[model samples]
Target: MPQYSIKDHLYESQLFINRSIAAAIIVTLMLLLLGVRMVYLQVVSHEHYTTLSKDNRVKLQPLPPTRGLIYDRNGVILAQNLPAYSLEITPEKVESLEQTIEQLALILPISEEDRRRFKKLRRQRRPLRQYPDPSTPER
Candidate 1:
């Protein structure tokens, strides 16, 4: 036969109740802190966040920077953008660029080498794509 002392103790109920109260108090404190932080963001730090949000939404540009004159020790212009004329004609503006090139050849001494170089530069500036004119039949 096994003998039992059977001392369950009366403090077990009090210990469980104390632990439950502590847990509830900790949870309530965490929720209180969260609520306080939310209120602080909405009311106290409102303008700061509003300015940042506005800065993202609005695009504010600065004035164009001025180009200054640069000179060397020997009074020579190191760099400058002086008034210069260039024969710039849009490729799309010209109906037949071959005829245009022939006309320009009459005025300027543009060699076959120069025409090849110009075509190379044009290819770099604009992508090569065949645009078939509906008015003229494709050759």
Candidate 2:
């Protein structure tokens, strides 16, 4: 049997209390630092981050000015402007493009000549280009 002394018990209790206090202080400091970092990002750096997020969204641009109208020798409009209707499709919105194209071919009166013309134009266009030519009426 070991004889317990008052000094030994007091020293042990003091050591345990000191370790507990150190652990509590470390945890509290970590929490405070985490809260401060969160506040900084949400409040101080919010505008910069918000702008970055907005930059990722789509941007629209207007077309440049049209060319001058051509005139004949008699000062009459020769190559005058004609009212044209244009339609555009965003590739991101289309699904199953091959199937859609096949369906379109069935619905529209696209001739064999038109398909060949499309193929020739497709070869000339950039690789990333997905939309059909705006010049084509049945596209």
Candidate 3:
């Protein structure tokens, strides 16, 4: 004859319920910790991060210092900076070089010497290049 055994249903149900409660508690605690850390970063340290972001966005460029005048031992000015204006024309931009020069002459005091110099420079310069006219009147 074989021996018979009975299952304890009540004890098994209690054990399963205990394990489920422990797992739920652990998950809830982890979620709470994550929420607290997010709040600290978003509210507490907001200004510090905001300032860093603003500084990164805005750039600072240093301006070049003005050049000083040089003098000789006898107090005579050896070298000094003077402002001068000149017109530059790009060969590619103008449709008719002769017509454009004529029109510019009417508006500005473009003398015969200026015209001749401009023509010479234009011929010597590589195509689509701009050369400063040497005949520009000193201001």
Order of candidates by TM-score, top first?
3, 1, 2
Clashing pairs in 3: none
**For every candidate structure, what is the RMSD over all alpha carbons to the true structure, in angstroms?**
15.9, 9.6, 13.1
The C-alpha stretches of model 2 lying farther than 4 A from their native spots are 1-7, 59-139
Q: Which candidate is the best by TM-score?
A: 3
Candidate 3, residues 1-139, lDDT tens digits: the string is: 9999898999999999999999999999999999999999999999999999999966666554368689999999988877645667787877987787777777787778777777787787798797665357533
Cα lDDT of model 2 by residue, 38-118, tens digit: 999999999998998888874555565487689989999977666554433444456864565566667666567766766
lDDT of each: 0.69, 0.69, 0.79
Write model 1 residue lDDT over 1-139, tens digit each, in one string. 9998876567888888999999999999999999999999999999999999989966645554367668999989998755432354456767987787788778767666667766665676664443322122213
**Model 1 alpha-carbon drift over 4 Å, by segment:** 1-9, 60-139
Residue 33 of model 2 has an lDDT of 100
lDDT of 3: 0.79
What total of clashing residue pairs does each candidate reach?
0, 0, 0
